[model samples]
Target: MDALQSSLLHQSALSYAYPLYRNLLDNSIVFLYHGPITPDLVVDILSLVENRLDDTGEDRRISKKLFNIMVESFSLGEDVERGHAVLLVRQLPYLYTVAIGRRIASSAVYQVKAFLDWVNTLSPEALREAYQRQLEKDDPRNLSLVGGVPAISILDLARKSHGILNYNFEYLNDSDTFFSLEARLQKTI
Candidate 1:
């Protein structure tokens, strides 16, 4: 239902809950639910629902409502079925782009810092490798960018979207150090 609803979900209090939804989407800590939901099945269902969506500007309020409602109702279901509830919660990342689509990530050092800050909360090694791998397969010179990295690149994918990222902004200035961002990320996120 989370994925299906995110086929577009946005609007007011529902949006207020998107941060909580995103936190649940974080991969570091898991709920450890007991049930029949295999991770593969959750991924498959989420991809199916997400694939059916178009790239227009509209967002999914219905999905947000269902997600919010599920947070309450799913816990009430039998323990054996709780895994499916957990699976649904896992889909919130799929809806993140929709929730934050309009926010400006304009050319700001803090924007990259902000992005890296968010990445710091998750597994940094995983996030770094994911983008590096994507960049290896494409030519990034033609893409719309924020700090030279594609603003909405496929690297930002939440395991639900299917798009090829064709950019690589790994070229850091001479003054930039490997530990620079990582140091700040560790401190904040």
Candidate 2:
């Protein structure tokens, strides 16, 4: 009876939680949460990340910018999922990045690719101007649930911060694919 109990406990502990806990410790993860997206969850996460950024003694302006970008990213992901999504954030010395992945309807792939490509073609100044133009629109929410204003804002931020905006798509069987989008913010030294 003792051996069986010990085996069960050991297996359970080694399965999921242990590796995740180890990674969290090893990676200096300031914020990590993935599950259902609720208003409360978003609020709590913003507060936690805000405090963590404060502790790092970073510039107040940069910290605020990063926080707002994060909130918009979370909001975008939640909108995509309608309830659930995955948000992964990693903090490094000079680079802070967040990748939000969600299952998206495959029909939207071309549109997403086109949008990214168009943004890629713009110079920093041009991007900023385009973003302002987007902001001038009344309502830009499409069927995909990605708001134009926030998307343009994020792209503008990525450009101004000398960071990168990237994406990857993996087909999940048929009629759907997992879309992972990442935005990075590089600290200027």
Candidate 3:
């Protein structure tokens, strides 16, 4: 490869990367991770987010809530065996958005969507009640073995985020569907 060819290749790579960089910047994305989600990675991500929040002088209360939401969101990726997952945190004018995406078995798509729809319909009080019931029913010791994590975590997420959970499913193929879940936390001044 000559110098000109090398330069062209570098420019080609930059051509693809610059747009993605701008998109992330324009969208106010503060953090992004796309790959397998593991416990260590979750801790590192949370630490980075915590540092960023502290640096920005974010409220302690809101920081705690955001941490909890991130934990639950990242846990969703633990079960993905066939595809990678995506986690992104975006800072907007009035709210913080935490979004997680993972590919799930096509057969589970309908059930997951229906469950999210039902959870989204509940009032805050009802969500609290549901969370309490799930907490009581779930055995902490067995949570990991059951299914990577339990639905109780989702309930907890809904309760903390004030029931503001958003989700979508993108059809990937006959065997898999990409599911994305997002929760928004309002910034209090």
For each candidate in turn, the TM-score is 0.20, 0.77, 0.86
Q: Which is the better candidate, 1 or 2, if ranked by TM-score?
A: 2
Predicted candidate 1 versus true structure: per-residue lDDT over 66-126, tens digit per residue: 2333232222222231122222222233332211111121334455555544544545456
Q: How many steric clashes between backbone atoms does each model show?
A: 7, 0, 0
Q: For model 1, how many clashes? A: 7
RMSD of 3: 4.7
Over the stretch 1-189, how does candidate 3's per-residue lDDT look in tens digits? 999998787666757798899999999998899998889988998999999999999999989988988998887777656668999999998888898887877777777877788889999889989778877777778652212235776777787788568988899898888888898888882
List residue ranges in candidate 3 displaced over 4 A.
1-12, 139-149
How does model 3 fare in lDDT? 0.81
Q: Which model is ahead, 1 or 2, in terms of lDDT?
A: 2
Model 3: clashing residue pairs? none
Candidates' lDDT values, in order? Answer: 0.35, 0.70, 0.81
lDDT of 1: 0.35
